[model samples]
Target: MQVHIRYFSVYGSTQTYAEHLAGLLNTSAHPLEVPLPDDATPVIALSPVHGPVVQAATYARKIQGRPVAVAAVGMTLLDVAREKDSLRKLVPEHVARFYLPGKLEFSTMSTAHRATLASISTMLRAKPVKSANDKAMIAAMGTDTDRMDFAELQPIVQWVQSLR
Candidate 1:
């Protein structure tokens, strides 16, 4: 079985993972904007997570009824149950899900995104009791923190290989 890799990336982290995963699978990665060659091919759609939203939800919906896996890239630390629960609301329950840590590059973000993050940071800072994750997010607001590790993609690679 041949698997196709498609990615929707705003800040490039998803694309990075997509390409690496493609390499591991001996396939090339294509942007989600490019239509898949066929409906029968299994797809691994990767997208960046913006809070509760998964950017590739629309694409995943369009590719329904085939074998599909969604890899959500975000800056937050892993909480499998939380992440999976968040993803279930956006992606169909039948779609397989995975989470990978992504980089936070303020410089690469658009003005609107930057402003939104600033607003969230302000809100989190105002909380009287903040969790460690909240504090980490606040600290990471303006800095470029690279949390992308190629080794983190091993699980994805294994999943793709299983298709064979």
Candidate 2:
């Protein structure tokens, strides 16, 4: 089946997941900015959480009425699974939502993001809180290695499989 994997990956975790998934399904992933006019395939909009929201609502708005699924990549996936409000804010009206954790390397962060992180620290009035040790488990490597294990990605994989 033709599938459109449109993603907005800031730190690349979701992009890695999209690439891995595309390889598994033998499809190519596309950027959200490019229009997919002739391809009638359904879409999967993958994004990561930033500050207070998933980093690309404008991109999300672009796919509103299309046949789309959304997966929110974040650090709190396991901890916030039952938080309907957070999940809702991530992927509203999506056919399905997948919670995937994200990783960050301050060195790799864009100047803007680094600045934003610095700003957050100032606001919180604390030494920069690193990605907490408790949340850095292998499973949480979904955020670290910029790769998510296929087994862990199965929920979205199964959903895509079911679509065909």
Estimate every model's Cα lDDT from 0 to 1. Answer: 0.82, 0.64
- lDDT per residue for candidate 1 within 2-85, as digits (tens), equals 788889888778898999898888899999988888567889899988866786766887785578888888877766434445
What is the model-wide C-alpha lDDT for candidate 2?
A: 0.64
Among residues 3 or more apart in sequence or in different chains, the pairs in candidate 1 whose N, CA or C atoms overlap within 3 Å are: none
lDDT of 1 at 32: 90
Q: After superposition, how far is residue 130 of candidate 2 from its true place, in Å?
A: 14
Residue 114 of model 2, lDDT score: 65
**How does each model score on TM-score?**
0.90, 0.70
Model 1 residue 3 CA deviation (Å) reads: 0.8
